[model samples]
Target: MPDLGKYADAVLSSYAVSLVLLVALIALSIARSRRVARELHEVEERVKHG
Candidate 1:
């Protein structure tokens, strides 16, 4: 907050966009990890039974 002066809008908007993208990336990664973990568990169960 140290006097962005004339470029305040541009700078703030960039920060907002960056934060949003970061959150979305994190969410997608967690979802993908969970899905892969579940699929691996299922495969392991099938192999054990077979």
Candidate 2:
């Protein structure tokens, strides 16, 4: 936590933006992975039965 002094607002805003983007990316990836996994499980079941 170096003293940002006069540059505090600019630095803080950039950090905030970065944090939001990273969280959004992680959330989307998790959702996509779940969907893909479900589809794969369904395909496997179909093949096993048919």
Candidate 3:
């Protein structure tokens, strides 16, 4: 890791927070996508049969 001089703590903490938020966003997006896909599949099945 490069020396961040006197702002090491601040910079590192910011990076950690940003990384956590990014991971959370990705997880939420994937979950929403799966849910939407499942709903679409169900709708399609109903349309096809009924």
Say which candidate scores most in TM-score. 1
Residues 15-48 of candidate 1 have per-residue lDDT tens digits of 9999999999999999999999999999999999
Model 2: clashing residue pairs? none
Estimated TM-score per prediction? Answer: 0.95, 0.87, 0.93
Question: Model 2, which residues run further than 4 Å from truth?
Answer: none
Estimate, for each residue in 1-50, the C-alpha lDDT of model 2 and write its tens digit. Answer: 99999999999999999999999999999999999999999999999999
Alpha-carbon local distance difference test for all models: 0.98, 0.99, 0.99
Instruction: Give the alpha carbon lDDT tens digit for every residue of 15-37 in model 3.
Output: 99999999999999999999999
Positional deviation of residue 21's Cα in model 3 after best superposition, in angstroms: 0.5
Q: After aligning candidate 1 to the native by TM-score, how far in Å is the CA of 23 from where it should be?
A: 0.3
Angstrom error at residue 14, model 2? 0.5
Error of 3 at 33 (Å): 0.4
What local lDDT score does residue 30 receive in model 3, on the 0 to 100 scale?
100
